[model samples]
Structure formats: C-alpha cells, structure tokens
Target: MKLEKSIIGMVHVQALPGTPNNKHSIEEICEIAVQEAKTYEEAGLDAIMIENMHDVPYLKGAVGPEITASMAVVARAIREVVNLPLGIQILAGANKEALAVAKAANFQFIRAEGFVFGHVADEGYIDSCAGELLRYRKVIGAEDVKIFTDIKKKHSSHALTADVDIDETAKAAEFFLSDGLIVTGASTGKAVYLHELKSLKDKVQIPVLIGSGITAENLEEYWNYASGFIVGSHFKENGFWKNPISKDRLKVFMEKVKQLKK
Candidate 1:
C-alpha cells in the first residue's frame, strides 16, 4: 500500500500444471520464476508481481484448488529469493483465491480485477467482489495484503456501465475501500490514455497505478500522473509478456524511470 512511483516488474509465471501451456514441471516453473524475480531485484526494480498470465482460457473465478496451490508454490519460491515486495494475482477475477495465495506465500499485495462494477470478460461475466474479498482477507488475517484493483480493466466489455464515466467509477472503488486503483488500456500491453490517467489522478485520493504499456518512450509522459507502474510487456523480449525477461530492455526502461524520478 506504500508504493511510491516506483518501477514494479512483472514475473509472469509460465502456464501452471493442468493448464494448456504446461510444458515445464512445477519445479521447472518455480525455478524460472525465482530467477526472473532475482533478475528484477538485481536490476534495481522496486518490486515484482507474479501472475499466472500464461494460463489462458481462464475460468471466471475459483479456478480449482490446483491453480491456487500451484500459485502458492511459485510465489513461495520467489519470496525466498528476493527481498523486493512481492505481489500475486489470479487470472479472471479470482480475488479471494489470490488473497489466499498471498497469505500462503507471504506476499505483500494482489492485483485484483472486478473489484467494482460488473463486466463481460472473455471467460464470462465478472461481478464486484470487493465485499466478499475484503471480508475473506480479514478472516485470513491478511489485512496487510494490499489490494490494487483494476478499473476499466483491459480485455473486457464495459458497455454494461456505459452511463457511468471513469471518474464516477473510480469514486465507487474508493468508497468500497480499495487499497489502490489500477488504470489500464483496452488490452494487455496497451498503453493507457494519458488524459484518462490525468483525470483520475486529479480526482482520486488513493494511489493510481498504470497497469500496462509503459515503455521508455512514454515513461516521462505518464510519470507526472501515475503513482506506480505495473509493467510486464515492456520488460519482456520484444515487449511481449510471455517472452523471457530482457535485461537489455529492462535496463533502458529503468534508466528512463531513474531520470524521470530526478
């Protein structure tokens, strides 16, 4: 919850066991995750977020115990290797399950989608889980696990809330007690509209993080408004999240962020 405009690198764990893209064994997956996390820490990034992004064709929520169990194992491995603040996020709005993984793995935060407003995602309709998720967090004694929720999340249809503007939507999340808010573009790896970010920054009191598409070219442009950046694609080879982490790409982006901080 205390993140300041710091660089947060993404550790996109390969397809977990039981998913379609599962080629690596669980041991192999964890080893890769730990290595990537260490690379981010060594590269001077402030924090690392571990996500099951490769688990494509995701279920809407409660994606079986295997998903949560696999995530906890990977998270625990990374937790042991790096001192950077660690975060976990379950695909397709499984916020409570994500909190469970965070608690089990001793993570500091979770990037949650569908914390407010309902949307038709590729998997199905995702309803607001703020009430259920917060109560569950309290029950597990994981109040320290901050929730950074996505507003107008990428890869979803918002036509259901066409009458509501983003400012109003953000206020709703704030009212619902979100730890912080994430603003993203239309899909993964897409850049957010600067005007939308600026508008939200002026109106929202809590932290406003850019959840996608922050490259060296636009870091300065977004630096003025975003409290933090949850980056995955820009750090990967050729700006693709599924590719291996590119030290060369990360170096250039971090250098730009360093200059912007000054």
Candidate 2:
C-alpha cells in the first residue's frame, strides 16, 4: 500500500498466551483488538497495524508456534471488521514470524526490526536479518507484504555502529532492499529529532516513517517530512500503552490531522 502522508494507527493487541504477562484469554484479546481497529478506521486513520507489544519480556529473534498462532487469529479477526490497509509486527526481531502472520492474515505490510546492523536491545544482541528475512519472504510468497525496517531503532543501543550516521544506515537498509524505513526516538513514546528526519529525507529515496511520539500537538513539525506516522501511546488512555484506546483522544488527534491535510 502507498503510505504517502499516511497515519497508521496501532492496535496493540493485549498480552496473549505463553507470555510472562499474558492476562487476557485469546478470545478477549481479539475482541479488544478489533474494537481499537474499528475506532482507528472510524477516526479516519489511513491504515492499521496489529502488534504484539503487550507481550512483555518479549522473546528474542524467534517466537514459539503458539505466539505465532495466536497473532494470526488476532490479526485475522481484526481484518474481518476493519477494511483499512492492515499490517503486523511481532516484537523483538521476530520478522519471519511476522511475515508469516501477515501473509496468512492478508496484511499489506510489516514493521520489521533488526533488518540491518546489529544492536544490543533489551532482549539481547540482534543480528542483521536482511539476507535471511528476504529469502524467507520470497519462499513464503509474501513478496507483496512490504517490510518497513527500523534504523537505529528505539529502546536499543547502536554502539556497534556508532560511527555510522543515520544517513549511512538509511542507505544500507535501502541497499538491503527495504520497502521503507522507520525512524524513532531513544525509546518508545519519545520524540524523534527533526534535523535527523530532514537529513534522511534528502538521503533516501524510499519512504521514511516516524514511528513514535506523534500526537495532535506536535505532528505539524514532522508532517512534511514523514511518509507516514505509526502512532500508539498518544491515542491511549492518559497516553499510556497498557490502557485501552481512548476514542475521545483519537477524535481530537484526527481532527487536527484533517486540518493539516487541508
């Protein structure tokens, strides 16, 4: 899907089974995810992305079959009700699993981590996955699923490639055949620097996305530079991730987005 100036609202699926924090049953989680997706569509978001963000202490690299299975179920349920272009993201560098889920759920794209360059994430060292991930995507016939990879991703230390600036990182991802690129702050819900985004816009040909800290008040600053915005925390109750999605907050934010579009 073309993501030009798009806003992809996040449907943070509730913690699923087999995680340390799994609280809700699979049925309950799917119901909540569908509701949030419906609200995003109703609020005029351009697309939706289902993520296993609530599965804290996330598994590194690959996840168990149950986690993959549960995500497929949740994503498919969300797909049935929400007509917008949908996407999926399995946490902590589970790119292959995410692609599989996306293929099965008819998702249009995926937010991939650690696609190029290694990093020390909370989960541990994440090796570059461009070669392996692309091969897997082709094998599974999921070439239609766009892979938007993160560069100098949040919540991780880029000490391994500290000498390489964001410009080079974007170029490397592009060289590795990324469909798009995602830029973010130091961590979740933090604001990304404006100058970095401006630099990337000049350096890369592929779409560049702002992946965190977007809200009604500050979106205008990044509006012209970003191809898309992947928003989550700001639309939640009290701007917290664990809380349910707040329709009132979504209405206010989308109103501002509409105004900017004009």
Candidate 3:
C-alpha cells in the first residue's frame, strides 16, 4: 500500500523495573504508555508505534508471558483513546508475539526487525523470519495487519549479509511480501543516511519509512524520499532515547512536518 508523507510518533513505553532491569512496575509502565499515547495523539501525529525499548538486555526469542501480557494490556488501552493507526513492536524479533498482540488489540501493523535478512544483533544472531512470521499471521488470520520490515536494521551487525547491498536487500523484502520497508541507522536513535533512503526508494515499490533519528531540522530533507518517519530520540529530553518524551519537542517537530506536508 502507498504511504503518505506523514509523521509517525514513537512511544517507547518504559518497562517494569526490577524484574531483571530497572525499578518500574508493569502498572507504572502502562500508565506512562497511556499518557504518552494520548500526548502523541493530541500532538496530531499520523500514527503511533508502541515498543519495549526500555526492556533492554532484551531476550533473544520469546520474552516471558509477563512482558507480552503487560505490553498487550497497555497497547489495548492506548488503542481505546487513540483513533490514529496503532502498531506494535517487541524487541529481538518476536514477530509472532507482536502479530498476536496486534491481532488481539486490533492494531494496524507491526515493526519487525530481522524480518527478511539474517543479522547479528546486540542480543545475538537474528535469523530471517519472513516465512514463519507470514505463516503465523495467516494461521492467526491477521493478514490485514501490515509487516514493516527493517532493511539494514539498526543496532545489529549485518556484515554476515554483506553480499546483499541495501537496494537488493530491500528488493528481496518486497519480493518476500513485506508490506513496508524501514531504513534505519547503525544503532537505535541514530539517523539514517539520505543517500541510502534514496537508493531504497528508487528500488522498492512499497512504502519506505525512516525508522530512526528524525528531527525537526532534517525532516524536510527526508520528506522528499521518505513516505513516513518513525521519530523517537529527538522527541525526548536532551535528544536522548532513554529520557522521557518531551511534549514541547513533539509540538515543534510536528509543526515542521506539517509545514513540509503543506
């Protein structure tokens, strides 16, 4: 499907502290997520994607039931208040669980890492999951929920997939039936290369979204090639991902994007 030039707000929900990571609880995390979702909606973002970014020291495969259940509950609550399109993303390529949550919450899409290419991420080796993930979606009857795969994904080592260039990798994803393609930088919250964005846009027929490091200053330059943007870090305090989402920052960013769209 064709994607319009729009701004997609990233809501990095805080994970419950003390389970293995920090000091927040599931309830606290959910509360923050709900509030952030409302803020993003009120800020007039085109869409919102919920992610367990704080669930650092991420698990390789399935995160236990508590994490999934907690995220689902929070995601469901966000869906209730936000009328914009909602998407879910779990860390470390848990595509099946993400699809299930999107299905249960009636979310529109999922941001999947390692969807079409094999890469070694911060956690460990992440194998391609297009075949199994699609089949899981089909079996669960959630085909309407789009899969946005990341090409040359951030925070991962793609040297193993070095034989395939960015353009060919994007083409492969399209051939494998990815609903959309995400182009990110080397790590989380990093900015993607405009040249890489152009190369992928020139190669793929599907929508191309900028997945990291979007800011008010660079929004216009990327608008020419990006169908949409997944902005997070710059929207946070001091432009750091670990910080809270800054309402003032969001307001300014959205204003610039609105002007560009006009």
| Ten-residue region with minimum lDDT total, candidate 1 | 1-10
Tell me the tens digit of each residue's lDDT in model 1 across 163-252. Answer: 988899999999999989999999989999988988997787999999988888988889989888988999989888889999999899
lDDT score for candidate 3 against the true structure: 0.86
Quantify all predictions' global Cα lDDT against the true fold. 0.90, 0.94, 0.86
- Give residue 40's error in model 2 in angstroms: 0.8
Pairwise lDDT winner, candidates 2 and 3: 2
TM-score of each prediction: 0.98, 0.99, 0.96
Score candidate 1 by lDDT: 0.90
Model 3 vs truth, CA RMSD: 1.4
User: Between which residue pairs do clashes occur in model 1?
Assistant: none
Error in Å for residue 181 of model 3:
0.2
TM-score of model 2 relative to the true fold?
0.99
Q: What stretches of model 1 exceed 4 Å from their correct place?
A: none
Q: Which prediction has the highest lDDT against the true structure?
A: 2
